[model samples]
Target chain A: MRPVFLIVLALISQASLADSPPLERQQALLELLHQDCGSCHGMTLQGGLGPALLPSALEGKSALMLTATILQGRPGTAMPPWSSLLTQQEAEWLVTQLKQPAPPQDANRH
Target chain B: MRNQNLNNFRYFLVCLMATVFLVSLPRAPLADVRGTGDLGLVVERTSGSLTAINSTTRRAVGKITGLGDLSHASLVYSPDERYAFVFGRDGALTKVDVLENKIVKRVEQAHNSVGGAISQDGRLIATSNYDPGGVRVFSADTLEKVADIKAEYGDGQLAKVVGLVDAPGQKFVFSLFEAGEIWTADLHDPKNPKIQKFKAGKEPYDALISPEGRYYIAGLFGEDGLALLDLWNSDAGIRKIVPEYAKNDPKLPVFKMPHLEGRALVGDYWFLPAVGHHEMLVIDRREWKVVRRIPLDGQPVFVIPRPDERQIWVNFALPDNDKLQVIDTRDLSVVQRLTPGKAVLHMEFTPKGQEVWVSARDDDQVLVYDTETFREMARIPAEKPSGIFFTARAHRLGL
Candidate 1:
């Protein structure tokens, strides 16, 4: 039931992307990755219950390795696969963003 | 007449000694606010300060500052509930007078530290360190170093210590995050202590003891399941409960590591957050078997069963962070889905379980609710408040 709903949502999201502005889609995806993926990957992507997702932390790991880990999470670990919710292209795009520097953290946040 | 005069003299002497003791101790203007230390401390993560709130009045009494990087900070209160020991992420341990709202003493004990626990006797404070990968004990009264025990496991390598807490008989129980082991230090003799060790699950992230101090359960992050230790009988060793429960279940991404600080002691059952799943696993404390699973909106970060065990109030990790759920203990179903605001980090019920206060981190406010109706009673502004610790914690065995 859940998988079927996710598939329908994916189809609608894709169809809407063609009609919706590209910048809006990009913003939504960024928010999805930042807030959704950031839940496990750490808010700053530094690390939490899961491993660190920082650029320096991912230094040696190739882009292919990260993309695979995102789409089809590593078995025997807490990392869950994002393939059902994220498209292949979206996963690849997320890897590129993660490879870049972390956003500026405000002084007030811990 | 002569005997009566002697008795009166004796009574006068006792009063004189009581006055001397009171004068010797540091005085605070608002120490006796509620007659009992039932006030709560809100850890303002971003601000590196704690806002003291009068639980009954629903107002901020005062704020104490100067602690550094409280990102993962944890606090424990003195037995009398007069002071709070703030354990900072930067490895600093500070003693603050809750009544006075000031840092009485602060010391940089390690390069980095997760948190600490105060000994059962309230005479010793032991810290779990990340840098030195060991536990350090300090004098609670003066903040002076007393003992240092290195958490070395295989090949003489020191491991980062996590889940440090004080148990009965003046013992500090903790787990090694890297070494996959648990150790109990007998601070009965603080200077020269005895230690008992047990092998726990892989990467036991954090652990909590039962309200009665019977079971020490550690949530394994690196692997599925948890490590259960029978503190009553250490010789039985550690047992794995719900062994590989995650293996058979569908892949669920654990949003954040569930904090095991609060006990899920609802009746005879123990409720715990399901790793990477939107559910709460209920276990029969007698056999430690799953009796039921309560489906929730998202991953539960804290499964805090109220003081009376009538209901369990839960908070989630982000993107479901803004929601709060109230589960009826009798039916084991959610009774309320509270939309408090963004990033509901932690919750604390009043000592009698009458009112629950929750910290909405991103909202920068702590919402107070009546437990019976689940109504928002008050909203107090805060700065990235994460943990809501009340003075009633002093009486609990393992906070």
Candidate 2:
């Protein structure tokens, strides 16, 4: 019974790990966030044509809702759907990153 | 002994003459002394540097670094074509001397700025800002604040300004993005500007002045039309052109907003990029009617004409960003297609328009091509370059 319980626990952990994007893909997503998204929402995510995505600006916003917006996109606006490029889990991860404080290193730094 | 002394005296006289001639001639401070007319600047966006290149030499002459946030940078040259005022995304306006290849003066004028323009006389420089939304004008020489025209509208709220361009009669014209209006600040009296406002279409994203500086057209992002203001006829108000050109078709996602500056006005037809569509709209400038819609591969970013106006070159947004298509003005058809490099950003032709320089950001190079033969002439190494502005832009009415 103990061996069976340990196998089930290992299976659950593996399933959760599969939900998150790999480290390499995360780096690419970050680049897209800074460069492509930065085209409209300033390079530092301070805002341009799009609104600011800083932690202060995104305060109290639902991460799930933001993830949905990222995947489905807002209609009648310049923000287009990224569902073709990003998965639900990946979109959620991007939202989590956006909600947190920006990293110390400059996005434009080579 | 007497002959030897005479020969030595003659040699001494020749040496004295040579020294006098060398001292009398004007001393050059630098080894390479050249005019700024043939020189241009390429904005190294990611690195925050400007690569000053000589179009005549087809090589980078110098790199001016330390201008902050050049991700969406643009520059305008002084009337003398010696100094270039670079506007950074972080709202820093840097005055760089192309001849000396250094920053002469830099001022952090706003929190976020888009682009700038120099006055007709080139005495004042005006920057369009997104944050604190207004147009700030400064003295071209000292970068001192000359006038600050706030884009206040609808219950005293500030709106972001875009498409700032210099018009005739010491005027600076720009479009209000949020307020959906166009304003002309007549700085004939720099301290006290006579502001004139015109109600334009919804979401005027960017604007461009005609080559003759008579028409100021703002491209609307929210609608399928453009706001046309005849600077020559100010009392007529704004007119909408090509309304509902895309009414039948669904709008596609625009990864990048199409830039309207330096648009192609070949002969009587005005070639413009249709937003959210892989097409170029040919409009008759005389009647302001859509003449033809040339289908393209992707959403067009810049539809610029070669100096000779024989051909129109176009670059696209993401997915098709690597491709560049050339259209023949005679038949208005896609004449040639070439994959220059990855993420092709901007292009600038030589003063006379013999060769064109294209910046490919991902490739980290600026490729030069011969206009007539359509062959690669040279490749310049750059660090994520974007805008390429030649000093010749100084002479053009609206660049």
Best by TM-score: 2
- Fnat of candidate 2, please? 0.40
* All DockQ scores: 0.20, 0.35
> Clash totals for all models, in order?
0, 0
Task: Report the C-alpha lDDT of model 1 over A1-110, residue by residue, as the tens digit.
Answer: 89877865674455345433365555666655544454444345545445667778899999899999988888766677777667777777667666755442334343
User: Candidates' TM-scores?
Assistant: 0.80, 0.90
lDDT of 1 by residue, B1-399 (tens): 999999999999999999999999887855555444767789987678999999878999899999876766789998889889999867889999888889999999987678899988889999998778899999999999999999998999988888888888899899998899999998877899899999897888788988778788887766767898888999999999876445334546554667885478876788888777788888887877888888999888899888888888888865588899999898887888898888788888888989999998768999999999887899999987888899888878877
Report the interface RMSD that candidate 2 achieves against the true structure, in angstroms.
Answer: 2.1
Off by over 4 Å in 1: A1-103, A107-110, B1-36, B222-224, B247-250
Q: Candidate 2, residue B252: CA error in Å?
A: 1.6
Give the C-alpha miss distance for residue B327 in model 2, angstroms.
0.8
Candidate 2: Cα lDDT at B150: 96
